[model samples]
Target: MVNTKYARVLDHPESSIRWDQESPLTMTVETREGEIETRYGRFVGGPADGVEVVEIDTGVMRVVVLPTRGMSIWKIESKGIRFGFDSPIAGPIHPSLVPIDDPSGLGFLEGFDELVVRCGLESNGAPEHDEHGNLVYPVHGRIANLPADALSIEYDEASGRLELIGEVMEARWFAKRLRLKSRLRVRAGSYRVYLLDDVTNELSKPATMQLLYHINIGSPVLDDGAVLEAPIEELAPRDELSAGEIDEWNQFGAPQDNYVERVYFTKLCVDDSNETTTMVRSGDGSCGLAVTHNVNHLPYFILWKNTAAKSDGYVVGMEPATNFPNKRSFETEQDRLVTIEPGETKSFRLSLLPLINEQAVNKTSERIKSLSETFEATVHRQPKAGWSDMS
Candidate 1:
């Protein structure tokens, strides 16, 4: 297989050769260039000369970048520890087309906390840009464009911080077109994205566009031990009419053992102390997950999962969105969607915090239990008569 040369390095490494090991061919790849000896895997309908599978094992994270027919991609895995490989941080550098679920309809990146979009207005056979790059939906005779993805990505050896930059893609009407700069710090165990609205021409348009961070938590992170704790009250759907059945339990704390989906336009105050919303994932609470949102802009949030028989139920797709499922003003033959006028935009920020033990979850767990008790006492109290039967 592909392991003949890699055998030597696998058993013994000179320094630290970030590497790869996969089966069928059983190939291996290390960062430090040696004989560069190897056999290759067939990348489907690619050229006769196949591509190399790169595994970036930079301690804090082991990112695997591979090229496929669907999307040229990169999968990030935690280094030293190999438990975090089930998810992918999919990439699209500018004119990107990837992990293409269905090049049409409402499909997005499969596994990623970030996506950098660029230039384009029309979508799904809709009219966005004209022959020359003039906006059909001009706010003031101008078209907002998205930036090229991947301005640069820096991986620090000492601290293990990944400084990443994704330029803006375009938006309709007059909004800013600026670069989105952010950093993924593994030690800090956090990621933050700054919305840049410093584009020329449309500075007067007063930069505006909707942005959301979609993350999938592979729970085991959500077994019976997991508990949901957040500062939310009166969680409502931006599309109150459409939220329908899913909106039934919007304001309550959810159990990790049960299946659920819904959104919340909450009233929970997030002072600095309440900056974290956590999920305790094991029975004894040895590990957990936490997420913090840019509460200012993403006042609206969505918690959805297609876990019925049709879709697998291993992980939960908890999306902290900036707006509703559909934009405010998108009208279809079936329904009228809300829309923003010219020169308008929206943005949001959030962090995926990992709380890794019982100590981390103790306070968070108590907070959730107290809130759940209070909510049940108010909304789901016992009928006085039922209590009388015991008497």
Candidate 2:
């Protein structure tokens, strides 16, 4: 059994330190003796102060957790493969410490370069004051920057699975009360990572809720010939820049100077499993990454592509959202906002799996192709089934 009693401050080797702090990490101090292990630590220095990182390895997959950022998975590695974008800006920056007037979303952007980043419990759009006339919500909402109030890490020896749990509360004495409880798990000798989230309303009144799984993919897995495949019923460009190159939405461009970002909103059709999937693979077809999510909870998909100068960063985001990231007011006008009544809870599930070889890539490609065809339901409607990466 794991024990928090063993937690302590851990210093980094001089050559291995990434931050300016002398000894910025504090974690549940434990020695690795098995193939599956979990560790939690924090940076005690300047920008990264109070930022906690948890590492979990299930022999086949290794994941880094950012507890300070709503338990976002910062990195995923396995079999010498890296599936996430490496942003020029590294480490976590608390949103509360950043100014809300910054239009570039710099505060949230600093940590946006991760494998997975949750968008919202209240809002995930452009900055604006709430309908109740409160101050504006920073870019992507407050959950990402709000540190988890409680955290636990455990390994199931019987199942050879590693689990990480984090609880974050977004409550002001008089405003909306909401709690986001996230549970993430990975199994031994498996190439998949699972996320199951539950968001509950603790207020006496109904509250607006919006969420998006921002899965960013870049170099290695994403290349010139890489394609974004999904059973898209229709596609619309977010702006004229995207409309200009709508024909090539599925293709990627070489990194360039002063490149403008383009976004496309796709209405997808799910398979019999009631799950929608999006994939990106290298031109060589040797490797790829596929993300599958419950379309019932997250029905919208946004493709955010930015192939700017190397220094600026290059990435493509395969985002699954409850609604498009326009202004909250705009989404309200469209009646797309998800409402959570008092004491009610909503569940969401998604899986990230690496396509290690061409066979795996081809299998995913075929599955996506089949999604466009008709298929009869064979299995019962199972909500938790989305946790399985095989989908």
Candidate 3:
């Protein structure tokens, strides 16, 4: 058996220590000569050694950015709280980490730790290209699996803010030339994680762009008695398997033997600020989590729930995207594809915060309620006969 015991301090001046069971051997130690007992810094040796990682900890939260993996946010942690999934493979594992040459879509699923960075500049669905075989986009595109060209981090002592910046290029000589410039900000003594992104078409010719923040949540934060709360205007199952239990879309079930996955497409209601939010809370009402994002850049939302057996690992995904992860060709047909003019750039912002106590959870509930009242809530009527399949 592997002994995964690890220890770390919470706040400066000797506060409490929290141990997370997500990663078996992960640990955070305070440095003697650091700014304040190791608040934030860049480090190697991610989930496993040899994998480069940059760790930034606000007294309230800790975020791990894998520079070698398209700057993916590999982990999110707080006192006795974890919001990401555990993969069988280790490290800030490289894209070629797997031995197979063509794992198809499964490649992305293998190293999908927490926040899998996505790029819509090329293709995002299964492996497929044009009839002429000129344009080739790998599964889930090539951003998350590609390494960042440049990575930097800065800490502001006066404002107690830490920012991690990463630049990733998904370009070829005669193909697309798109750049993703991402910045993540965390404030001391706060539970919020802010993300500001700017995707630019670096080429002289126009290029199609699609970006999705695939945020996955699992375990303690997502268990029985958990409920999904959002200003949802409409909900549709992805396929026949999910449509069977369409009524239970907002509730989670215990791990079962043969539990199939279900995905719900939601039309969310945005506030006057043009922002939409979603919350997932523990059944006991102890702790919870919330995600807020602007709707202008991200107009679509997807909720993926998988209640597979315990051995398989249970997880839920909250995806915000400019276009669904369908084939780029299909997205173009729907006219949902976003085109960036030569040298044109667009921005997207979002934040994730942990609801530590009842007060925090209640605040989220109240906020959702206010939004529901302020805007018109979509009334979902039962399927007239059999459920409609949209997958």
Candidate 4:
């Protein structure tokens, strides 16, 4: 490896070092424990685009987390303080291989000039076991928050208490598009998204309640081969479908020639391994994530990917959600529809459990049943024993 001593400081425990290389943003750090070393530190554009390298310790754990286009975390001052996550140059809005929106002729979803997901909130639906021992996936509601004037900025530096408190928002360093109102988590912590014209809304209910968020989970090591492992309890198939209608991934049919939309493997049990999902581009981001969680009320899960069509060999976009896309009206239903009466409020909490590929996928379901501490079914809906992954 070409090692060059770039001018920077290394903080211990929570120490960090940043280098403004000729290209992309790169940062490095060492844990206070001093046993961990991070390398391959980089930033990319959006959930489905370019990337920079991110590393920990001395190549111990590497990750390429960021978008493909607008490396906001790396390009803070370049786009000025007032930046948008819309990349008009990003082309179309289609997860071609999956059930992503085909927002063609209908015009695009106000893309980013550098194109990051521009919508205020983006959500995924999945299924699995809930905290109370119930089947879950595609939890209700989405994840996204915007302070009155949220900007796409970069993390000029990363260290202890990594954050920048703005007027209405707070930005953190050593993060993808490292700019967010620290206060955002205060209101958005519970996933109970709310909007009021008089409070934070620029206008009243307005014409539509439109919000789009590109929960970027980018990688910059795709050429080295990409591997994503997401586990769940069950993968259910959908019932009742209309011609050319949107259906679940497990229920998709054969495609004549063009690329097929996405296939969703629903209701998989979020066992120990299932909870250990992570994004790896090439060899970067190796064991960068330890665990994850669910934000919605449901426990189901959905996986997203950017297949062969993607240009960069160093980028990957994989996500596990709770429900299907555009299924807002389906909330609180037997499947996943919200049943709220007049002026009702609800909250959802989700966490993450990142693990290595070998630990996440190699282990079989038998191991889960054997290791399961407390396994119970609160809602014994007749197991739909049908739906499966089409891809």
Candidate with maximal TM-score: 2
Q: Is candidate 3 or candidate 4 better by TM-score?
A: 3
Runs of candidate 1 exceeding 4 Å displacement: 1-104, 109-162, 171-178, 188-204, 224-226, 237-267, 272-276, 280-284, 309-313, 330-348, 363-391
Instruction: Rank by lDDT, highest first.
Output: 2, 3, 1, 4
Model 4 residue 335 CA deviation in Å: 5.7
Q: Which stretches of candidate 2 lie over 4 Å from their true place?
A: 1-34, 44-46, 94-96, 100-106, 129-135, 374-391
Ranking by TM-score: 2, 3, 1, 4
Q: Give the lowest summed-lDDT range of ten residues in model 1.
A: 382-391
Q: Candidate 3 lDDT, tens digit per residue, 1-391?
A: 4332333322211212232333312333333322321222222234333444555666666676676777787767778677676433433455667321243444566666554455555665545556775445556677777777566665676766667788888888987888888888776677888888888998889888777777776677778878888888666666666667777887887777777777766668888899988988888877877889998988878777876666676777787888666666667777777888999998988988878788999999888887777566453333211222243
Identify the leading candidate in terms of lDDT: 2
Tens-digit lDDT string for candidate 4 (1-391): 4443332222111212333343222333232323322233222223322132232222222112122222112111110111112222342211221122322211122322221222212123322344574433222111122222331212222221111122222122331121223211101011111111111222222111112222333222233333443343444323222112222221212212333334333443454433323223223333222224342333444443323233321122233333344433333233443333222323333322223344442342233344333544232122233232111
Kindly indicate the candidate among 3 and 4 with the higher lDDT.
3
C-alpha lDDT values of all predictions = 0.33, 0.73, 0.67, 0.27
- Candidate 2 or 4, higher lDDT? 2
**Across residues 79-185, which tens digit of lDDT does each residue of candidate 2 receive?**
78777775766455554554534544435665565678888877886566565755566567767777786677656666666668889998888788889999897
Which pairs clash in the backbone of model 2?
A: 24-44
Using TM-score as the measure, name the better of candidate 1 and candidate 3: 3
TM-score on alpha carbons, each prediction: 0.51, 0.84, 0.82, 0.39
